[model samples]
Target: MSTFDTDLLIVGGGPGGLATALHARRLGLSVIVAEPREGPIDKACGEGLMPGGLAELTSLGVDPAGMPFHGIAYLDERRRAEARFRGGPGRGVRRTTLHAAMAARAKEQDTEWIRTRVNTVEQDAHGVTAAGVRAKWLVGADGLHSSVRRAVGIDVTAGTPRRYGVRRHFKVPAWSEFVEVYWSRWGEAYVTPVEPDLVGVAILSRGQPDLAWFPRLSRQLAGGERGPARGCGPLRQVVSRRVAGRVLLVGDAAGYEDALTGEGISLAVKQAGAAVTAIVEGAPESYEAAWHRVTRNYRLLTRGLVLASTPRPARRAIVPAGRLLPSAFRFGVNILAS
Candidate 1:
């Protein structure tokens, strides 16, 4: 293994970590990204981009043409959105496409990347150490339950783990214009436009990974078209957590919610900018403070989604109410998505 030194070290090359490397390089900071995985790692996600997050990409100067994707669309069990996203362009690119583009950008910036799993991280006043790489600043772009967060002596409170999600992709037409999030009593399936012929699909429920409903989820997104014959897993995880320290956690590393909201990847991208800004200037608190404000709205909307996916009739009742009163539902969503 090669021992490296830099001004900043990022441990994870997912969206959050990659964005960190990209921005830090632009600012002329000496940086290295140590991602255990090579290329784009597949993830269970709806892959929808919101306006605020997309704007950040433009601000960073990344051209989406390099990674083509569908525009936007929205749908529900009850009423349907008559208009496409009033906001500017947002893509439903595949996770691999987004990752590949980011990887390409980071490499172009000469952000030293190491493809190896981090054994652990140790931190002090000067900076943090991951695997063997050390730097002046440390960022945990890792994920929920971040090893960096724990190593930095930060502990996060987590709601009892509930809700699970499974995401897969297939060729489909844009039945609607925005990423269609189909609300249901059991769970919600989000259909996203990733490419001209491909759509990313996900079904998330609270507490457990599901299997039985894959067929139903496929049917909804297809507008009656036949979906993949096999099935997808119920990718399951907890609701939320907060890691506080100089080494901050962003994206799912910060917290997780129901995937049906289609905000995870975009949220990570947004937090990456905020976290880098916080570290570059000198006040790390700003990143944490800012993240709470931004992440809170998404959490609120996601919590409703979590409740709607629950098996209990009482808890699941929120589904129809949300579908019927999109204003109330959309209010939280708009706050989060923007």
Candidate 2:
């Protein structure tokens, strides 16, 4: 028999990994998380937590402080459309704030942490080892470019219409209760109210982002204290599979589409639950199907929207279509929300 340092060794200490730790602890499994960064790690994101996602975090005893948004609004120079969430209001939390809350909750649950980056992985029929820890199962919750995914031989390739996102905070009061998305020929700018006096703007585009794309939004943000910018890219990551032996992928490392729909964190949290459940069942490979089920709606809707918005004409029609077909818009929003 092989002795193990923990029941689960999770690489990356982001929301997904922490959530996995919390779930594992709840199920009486010892977990060790390896993350190179310190607490309150910030990332380039829209910062809007959908109602479903907020509920998931709450269930885990993590409630980050931020502004509450009732729905999502789509806008252009001439038109606008809004879709309210049916269940409850979502929160727009800063990435750092969310991370801190999750980390604290995981700590309270007795999840151990190792400050190291996992570059290589070694697993056998008995257990897996990485970052100097041995465990019965391994989970890769690392971001888009996951080394563990590669170390486990999971094939990944970049997808087309390669999109990138750049985000920063502005010291201005939020004007809308809805998370607003301003569209232009250049790209889309997502304005999420993360705090009463601060809003986060994330630009998504095929090329480098420029605020000139949305003149009105730029003007509205003029003179506000601008924080340092952060960026992430080629939003679409095509993964061949989610499971390799005893290792399972979660969060962005599992797979990714585009951030246009704003449900990344929610999906990550949900996936963490599924991953932990698979591990607890002693059937790691079952997580692959579970992953597909969790991400099916997000994949279909987000991919279709991304494709539709790729063309300039279709991009221009999005808000108008939502305005004309309010029921369809609400249905789509509610589907992703659930």
Candidate 3:
């Protein structure tokens, strides 16, 4: 048998990567994590942690502070509908705050971190290696464009009408208890309250992000202190598979559809636990099926909604549909919440 430097080597240092490190440690595996960026890392996101995701993080002993939201609200020029999560409220935490909390938790669990990016991934029967570290198993928790996924020949090409997200913070008083999704002619604007006086506005659209496109949101945010805008995506990535040999992929690195549903963080955390379970059981193949189970709801619902909203007329019907079918809409919200 070959010797290994660590029980597991994790690529990427974002939330998924750090969460994997913490979970692996809980399973008695020694882990080394490689990440190029320093904390607390910020990304363009809606910043809303769904109730299910919040519980997952709390269960992992990571409870970050932020504003609480009762549920999700859909609004348009003519219609509006809101539903509260039956279980609990999701929190709107800043990306940096989330990163700091998760990173601290990982460090406290004794997971070692290397400040470097993973450029290559090599594997064999006995072990896998990346970023110069050899381990019994390797996990790719890197983001949308994961090098490990590419190295393993599982990276999927993104197809269009590829949606993109741009998020900016405004120093304005939050006016609602629900995470508001404002639908306009061009795209959707997600307003999440991260603090008592700060709201983050994230736009998801195929067209270029112009505030003029969301006239209502633009006016509401007028006169507020604007923070630098951060952007991400063409918002769709497909993976041929989640596992190859002794290496596995987790979080966004595994596969992604869109951020329209606001389930990213929670789903990633759950996938981390599943990935570690498969690693601990010495069954990489099992991770693929487990990944499917973990992401099934997200993939199906997000993809279906994206498809439904692709056409102009259908896009206009979303808010009104929710308003007309409150029960059905609430069921959808509760399903994702739990």
Candidate 4:
């Protein structure tokens, strides 16, 4: 008989992994989270949580503080379009704030944490082992460049148009209640109001991100107290599957699409629940289909938007099109938000 340290050993203690730990504890499963980073982990992201994602986190008993935006806005030099989520408002919380809330909730539920990084994984018919611990099941919730995914031999490749994102915070009062996405010839800049006096700007593009690409936005942020810039990507990660024997992958480790639609965190939290569900049911393979169901809308919509925005003409047309077709824009936004 094999000895187990916990029922579930999660590699990575970011939002997704911590969420998985929380879910596992709710179902009476012992969980151990291995993460090298300390609390309040921060990352480069748009920092806007859709209503659907907020609901998921609320259900998990985590309520992070942040500015609440009722809708999304797309803007260009002259045109602007807005879409309010039909369901409710989404919060624009800093990455660190969100992480801290989830981590605290997980700890309150008595989830164990270990300080270590997992470089390799070993699994057998009975269980899986990594980072000097053994568990009946394992999950990889690590980010874009996941050592756990690679260690488990999950096939992954970079998607086309190879995009990347960089984000920085400025100590300027948010100018709008909506999460504003500025469209430019070079790329898009996402301005999210994370706090009353703070806004996060994330740039996504095919090449290196530069705020100068949007002259108006650059001028608006010219003299604010700017925080250090953080970056991530080649945005799209194409993974072959989400299940490997006793191991499962969630969040970016499972697979990823471009962050053009700003649904990454919400989708990740949903995936965590699905992962824990499959584990509780003793059907790890079910997680693949569950993951598919949870992420289908995000993948399709985000991928479609990424492809449409690849060309200069289509990119320029986006804001105008949103203005021209307000109903369509609102419908699309609400679908993702739901």
Number of the top-ranking candidate, with lDDT as the measure = 2
Query: lDDT tens digits, residues 132-194, model 1?
Result: 777777777877656766666555555544455666666665444566655544566677766
Full ranking by lDDT: 2, 4, 3, 1
Q: Which residue segments of model 2 deviate by more than 4 Å?
A: none
lDDT tens digits, residue span 1-338, model 4: 99999999999898889889988999999999999988689999899999999999999899999999999999988889999989989999999999999998998999999999999999999999998899999999998889988998889999998999999999998888899999998899999999999999999998888888888788888789999999999989999999999999989999999889998999989999999999999999999999999999889999999998899999999999999999999999999888
Where in model 1 is the C-alpha error above 4 Å? 1-4, 65-84, 156-158, 207-217, 220-245, 308-326
lDDT of model number 3: 0.90
Ten contiguous residues minimizing lDDT sum, candidate 4:
213-222
Q: Each prediction's Cα lDDT score?
A: 0.65, 0.93, 0.90, 0.93
**TM-score leaderboard ranking:** 2, 4, 3, 1
Cand. 4 Cα-lDDT: 0.93
In the predicted model 3, the residue pairs found to clash are none
| Worst ten in a row by lDDT for model 1 | 230-239
| Regions of candidate 3 where Cα sits further than 4 Å from its true position | none
**By TM-score, how accurate is candidate 4?**
0.98
TM-score of each predicted structure versus truth: 0.82, 0.99, 0.98, 0.98
lDDT of 3 by residue, 1-338 (tens): 78899999999888899889988998899999988887698989889999988988898889999999999999987678999889979999999999999999998999998989887888999999888888999999989989999898885989667999999999999988999999876889999999999999999999788877767677889899999999999789878999989989998899889998999999999999999999898888988899899888888898998888989899889999999999999999888888
